[model samples]
Target: MEAHTDIQTTQKGFRCTLCDVNLPNEPTVDAHVKGRKHQNLFRLRETRKRQVQNSVFVSGIKPNTLSTQLIEYFEQFGPVQDVIMDKEKGSYAIVEFEEQASTAAALHRTEHVMNGLKLRIKPRESKEFKVVLKKKQDGKNSQVNLDALSQELCRAASVNEQMLRVVESFQLNENERNGRELLVKLLQEVFMEFLPDCEIVPFGSTVNTFGVHSCDMDLFLDLEKTRTFQARSKTASEPTGEGQSEDGRSEDSILSDIDLTTATPAEVLELVAAVLRKCVPGVHKVQALPTARLPVVKFSHRNLNLHGDISIKNRLALRNTRFLQLCSELDSRLRPLVFTVRFWAKQKQLAGNPFGGGPLLNNYALTLMVMFFLQNRDPPVLPSVDQLKNMACEEEECVIEGWDCTFPSQPIAVPPSKNTEDLCTLLAAFFSFYATFDFSASVLRDKSFQRECADAEKYCRSLQYQRKSSKGKSWGLVRLFAPSCPTGAGAGGRQGQGEGKERHLELSLPFRLAALPDAVQRRLGTAGERFREQWFAMVRLAVETVFQEVLGCSPAQEEEFEGQMDTSTSSDAVAMDTAKEPEEVGGHDQTEGVAAPSGSSGGVVSPQAGQKRPFASAETSPVSPQEKRQKLCAAEDEEEDEGAEPAPSASWCWLQRHPVWAGRRKVRRDLLKARGVTGGGSAEASQPDGGGVEMELQVTRHITAKEPDPHDLVAFKVGAQVVGGSENTRAVLRFTPLCDQKGHFQDFFHFLEIFLPKTTEAFLGK
Candidate 1:
């Protein structure tokens, strides 16, 4: 077999570097090498190479000189292939010849003339050939600017002023808005040539008055007039079998390819995509997403560095955009409040999923949430949507898609809000309002978002959030905008300090019986009112299995509490308590075990009655891992004790002897390969059964067997308790790292922050 520079042999397959794809076998590799995408990229690379070699950079050309005149002048030396002018500032252009010799000939002349004006000509600069990576439309540059913005906001006179500064820093500048307007006009002109009378209406963030820099330009392409024109042209030409309209325009244009009245949304979108790709200059990456909720043709303008979506069936979005604009105008406070909340949500990772569709909340949804909060304020900062519809005159009344969208066309038509709360107070109230919102009844039922709102509400009441800092530390809006850690987890003992201190790490595994399959739910229901206690015991066993058998950790001292202990103690105190009396590794001297009651299938013991048991060692335990997992499902049915305390907690110490958290993903892949499993696993592995647990255990074992043994990195104490009321039950685990002279505990703890919950869930689901 011949080797290609772009193709490299991997363990399981051959990888194509140019396309960033893997091919499984010789036949697939051969097919991929001959594929259209691979061939197109190869030709593009060669064309770019030729352009660098055969092009001449022309300067000092007259601004109004046409590309045709430049082409005529350049052809004197040799045939001119292309003339690319600087459209923004027509001071220079690049003229490409048919051959490199012609470029040399033109460069040697030193002077060129076009339309009686002398032009400076030089050989085009040589450059490396590299593929242009697709630009992510996430507005990441705007996020980068936020670091500078925080410094600027820190010097503000008050939190209200800092918020205004945030708006000033993020909103589109004059140049940016002008560029978008020009782009829209350019698009309008291009689409008019093919689909006559079509109008491109800008909507969403671009014109919603709450726009940020680099936001995507959402355009509603109104083709109703064009559809009428098409029908009229078809009728006019039907009698003569000719393709000319009454206005003498050619009816045999791109519109002739499809009947707008009869065409499917996907078909029309494809036509739009074709027009964008073929006719629009500087437009690339044109894609038609017909399957989207609102079918759209997504495109990017190369020169403008902007991404945009063109939708033909989104008239409702235009009305919604106008409503947002009117609301922003009615109350001056709305714009800054929306901007600050959006930024805070972005920082908290509760919103802004870059690729559009995900669990994260979008900007529009977040804006509406703010409006809803305002509408519910004590004095009512904003009117409800239905109320706004009533406020509009009869002449302005309108409906779209079976829903009323009428609103006052101008801000002057509506009365001012009576609520006179300052931006600071409104911002704080926005957080506090949503902290206790009933999201389950609405579409915004994301628990993580609710938790973040509660945290922000607490911060908003603090002095650090209400006032500026005198010690020049981050305070007010700056502190609020800082990226937050996961719910119960904190960074070391203090914020951002990881080394030379005791670290406190916590994770919450909610009782998600409702999220389980019906069969699993039925099995859990068999435990009756004592289900919570049994579930907690199952979680404890899962945690022990993950640390000992799966993660190669040795169990130390273990303690169980009958009721909730003080959770407000400092990390230093927790560390001192663990250090004061260290128990021997894998010791059962101080441990007591209470066997499961009456008819329990397995000999599973309850950790509740101040009873503890050592975790089963991988090499020494009589039971297999699968048996241990089965024991978790065999819970004892017990009657509920009405007078019992709601919370029972357990604490255990573990000494980690390996970096089990590191490189587990690669090892997992290798182990799956060894087992001949593809796509992670088959359908059974995806089930909530014990398949995932066994796979993860195998992954850890593979890593431990391959890597050299290291000295003890850290010893941490984990305390577990079932918290939350009836509606939101969860197992909360607080980790206190007692010994960390090597500083590896923080990394391990951060890994467990995500790992422990997921693995434990798999165990409990089994």
Candidate 2:
């Protein structure tokens, strides 16, 4: 009678109609619902549910006899359960156990078998179970399972053991095909030890289809679980955990700008990075790059032979991540083509010099070439980053996790192995198609883009940076540099160690506390030593995120897509708007502004007038329907191909068309010459022997709307001309300064995401 009563109570508490142990408030009995134990339980529940939903399941077989079987030997672990094998049409079964514990045991122990053959054992499942496991999805209406994803990829690769460890027996070496990825993964594992939840993702040619002999890793760092951890910790500390969350929601500045209670993703990432860098090793060059459209940091440890950047953002980071991720996917197929084209380029000696010439081939030049190659294909095997985002699933509609780590992918459908197509035709198609791809809309339609135009408008208002003491104009320069972007102008060669190009390479190195002036460096070194905990924490996160998630497509689409085709891009440029500021090419831009007076909607300018209009809605507007259809053209041209044009002979060459960057070359020249400089020539100062020259350089502190300065002259300040141009004395650093026409350049490497590279003085700060 007592046993019966216990069984009845268990049934009541177990919440399962078939269970009988309803022990009340007994932590021991309910311990399964807490800690990793609980997570393990949920995992089992989901696995079982998937099997049931897929119409396949486990069944009868005694313990000892069934260990080798799949989906059948589950009955050995507990009380006997009803095993109904329905071999009718579907490949499944239903095993209802007498106790809940037995079912859990079955899930943990089940072995499968079919037709005198052993299959992989999984637990019983049901439609209801799937619904339960999909709470995050049902709560919003999207289905993205990251774990199953990892499993699927593992199964696909057939890498039975845990993590992928390349066998040492083979003659191993970093090759164009896999060096960067292999390095990124090694870095990821090291950083992961420090940042359990942060992510490291690689994008661009390093992972793209068109990658060649020498390529750079386009990385992004991400943190999504940090917020949940913070919230939970707070809840655990406070009695009114739930109440405080709801009440504190309004305290967030973004609460006013957006309905979302979450504060800035940038801020959260900052905190998380600070927490992880403390535990990571060999992360010496760690530094922040907050101004990057995605707040980021770049670093390298020669000891480990790893160098990369980290974009610190929210879970939604996948949007931009997927952008590049998709591009990388496209590259997988485009790579063979890249190799072919590059071989042709080398044979033709068209790889431009590293100091900015077309004959010198850079990774960017190669990507452009490949883009042209595919656009010319019969069916265009790869879509532009803009177009591919359209096919990605929306964030609210899907939740992706562990996207940045590594995973096996589906093979792309390429032309027949021997399908020979001329490079010229492929080249033509790329130029025509990309030049006209509709960007403004394609970007917003990203699977995870939360199209809160109003909220974005508000956030734009709050972007204030620290102001400089110098009152001169401050220009906002935005640029993205990766091997994939145009690196050098001539044939694909670069100056080495002691050549003048060394200066540019120096400019490219990440920061070192010791590199600063004695005073500044001392302070930083002390700060690093004292705050070593926080410093390491931040560095570890920055490194982890760059390799974990920044380069990965979100699981909802990316993981699944990888199973098919990857399509991530290096960066997403949904340009922001900015207010007018003074014009000065060399002016120091201010990053500060008064908080706009409080109003209903939030913005950077704080709706100075009425929270209605902060600045003209410079938000990138969508294109027309007709144009959209034209964009969908099967044989469209490559809209933004940097190739297909002759290299300009002069810095002011564009003046024949627009003369945008041809600043006051004469006046600037006079200013420098008056100061004892030799050809300090700013046309603005010199009345052109032929005519007057004037070009307004828009300068502002906020980077949101900064227009690009004209291109810099390729000539050395001393103008050795043809003299000293040999290997002994050429330009040291040949990389184009990371700036853009719309003040847009995606430098995968940047200092604090802005300012000058301490190692390189091309920017004002140096």
Candidate 3:
């Protein structure tokens, strides 16, 4: 078979480097090579190559000279196709001709004149064509330079000064702010030309006082005046039966095509996207997300290296941005405290999903949480939202989308907060306050988040958190921002003195009955008094499936246990069982156990380990869903006496040979695209949490097939139990690695920390 440079063979398939896509076989590869999209991109690349070859870079042109003028002067040599001017400085322009000879002709000329000014013409610079991957503006890389940032923060004299350093390091600089402002002005001008009286208002993080570098620019397209203009134009045109008025001004064709007031949000967003794609210079990757919670037109500005979103009806967001600005103005300490807390949350992985949608908390939620904590302070460091509304005068009143968004337009109209706490103290207090907060009754109820707050609270009390390290070690805010480690594991590896010290990784999947589909919820409700046990059994099956089927871990041997086993008392698992209706009582009661294998090693447990029994076999005869549910329920009821503690538990032992976690994301994305799943769709392939169960299974298969077989990485035991008192139910998995010669277990455990719960939810939700 002939070989192609662009097509490379992998363990599972062939990949097209040009299109960045994977093909499963020779036929598919052939089809992909002949695809329209691929062919178009190939032609486009060729065109760019020709442009670089036949174009000349011209300088010394007048600053005010337009591209059309340059094109006219360059046309004397040959036919001119396009002219690209440096809009920022206007010092240079690139003019491309239809023929290669045109470049030589232009270079042959002794002098070129544009508006009677001599121009410098030279061959255009050539560069390689490489795909630039699109990156979200989320602050996922805030820790990328942690070592450098820590070194700087460690030099601070105190925690208060350290926090000030954080604000300085993360906040947007003047140049960035100016660039955003220029982009906004340009957008305003372009939109006005098409839709007269339309206003593009900047809001969100860019205008909000808490903005960080690289945060997205959120714009609200206010079309109220434009709608009115269209209405007036329609009335005027009715009498004349023409699109133009007496003054010779004609309604823009784009605006005449649709009535903004009557159009659907999707239609309006499509129009906005069209304008952004066709009219805006330096803008690309324009997409209309009409199905989002807040319909928006997403775009990227290449010159600014910025991503932005434009929405048609987001007046409330504008008001919220103003509110945040007012809060920052009222208290100078608020900005530093918010910034520090947000960074801490990002480090702890309690907030900030790179792709936007996930279970993780967002910056806005974290900021609001800080404000809520401040409002509860002894002196009340900040006013409540309702209080702010009350403070607004009659003329200052504002309403949007039937929501009372009233707030003083200026800080002078409101009184300053009476709280006088320092930034360090307030930051520590913020963690302390949320540590014991009853999340079940509040909207921030996520067990993992509360556990993180409690951990941060403990760290805040340590001497290292309060003062700088004299020995140049990580301390104060620096230590607080470090990635959290598992129990018995220090910053890098096992902390204790014993070489054989056992390390455990724990994760909890809370029973969110409300989040389940109605049919599933009704089925659980039908289970009545046994609902918790049934749900726990189902979760046990899902965990087994994830380990053996999805993650490609082999089943070793199932061990039968009669009593509750000792579990870790680490702070990470402190409140693992707590929830709203039925609160966790801080313990587990074991009933049964199942052993499963993990990794490529395919190792087996020793016969002397224990008696073996399978609760739900991952590899066996396929059973009907109803039969499987019945078997799980029957297993829970087996050997159970009346009035006994009803905790249905299972355990699994597995061997993992391959690092399935490595490159799992890329594999999953490729699999999703191969399956014709892209964008934000309802399918599991579009999910940020490792996609759906089947998709994840495919991803694991692809990864393991490609990954080299190494020695047994780690053999671990998984203990699953259902815990929660009356209302809240949760499934807790406890991981205990039998061996850790190379410390690969920690990495595996960390991946599971997020992957397990999310994938389990995906399974249960299905």
Give a tens-digit lDDT track for model 2, residues 598-645: 221111122122323212121311221221111100111223233221
Score candidate 2 by TM-score against the native: 0.29
Candidates' lDDT values, in order? 0.71, 0.32, 0.72
User: What is the C-alpha lDDT profile of model 1 across 1-766, one tens digit per residue?
Assistant: 4567888999998998877788888877787887778888888878888998999889988767777788888898999988877755678889999999998888888556667798988878878666666657555775577678879988998999998998898899899999999988988998898889989999999999988878899999898999898999877744444777787777645788789999988998998887787557788889999855468999999877889999999888888888888898889888889889998888776788787655468888888899889999989999888888878999899899898888889877888888989999998898888888865334443456666676678778889888888999888888788765433321111242221132234566777786566775786688555556656766776777788877778665333221222234323324322322221111111211222322333323443466333222223322433422222222123343543333434555677877787766656655556778854267533432123677777777777776484666667767666555555666667666655644677678757755676677776665
Model 2 regions more than 4 Å off: 1-196, 209-214, 237-278, 292-294, 314-333, 340-362, 379-766
Best by lDDT: 3
lDDT of 3 by residue, 1-766 (tens): 3467779999999988988888888977876776677788788889889989899999997767877688778888999987877755678889999999999999999887767798888999998777665555534464457777888998899989998999999899999999999999999999998888899999999989888888999999999988888888877744444787444567788898998878998998998987787568798889999866578999999988889999988888888898899999988888898888888877666788787655568999998988889889998988888888888889988888788888888888778877778888888788789888866434444456666676677778888888777788888887778765443222222232221122234577888897678887898887655677657656776676677777877554323221212234322222222222332332333333333222211111212224232222434322323212212221123343444454556566676878888767767767767777765555665566455777777777787777465566666667666666546677767666654444676678767867887787777787
TM-score per candidate, chains pooled: 0.58, 0.29, 0.61
Model 1: runs farther than 4 Å from truth?
Answer: 1-4, 7-129, 134-144, 237-244, 247-252, 355-359, 441-447, 470-473, 485-629, 633-642, 645-723, 726-766
Q: Which wins on lDDT, candidate 2 or candidate 3?
A: 3
Residue 211 lDDT in candidate 2 = 38
Off by over 4 Å in 3: 1-5, 8-129, 134-144, 237-250, 261-281, 285-293, 355-359, 440-447, 470-473, 485-646, 650-719, 724-729, 733-766
For residue 627, what is the lDDT in candidate 2? 16
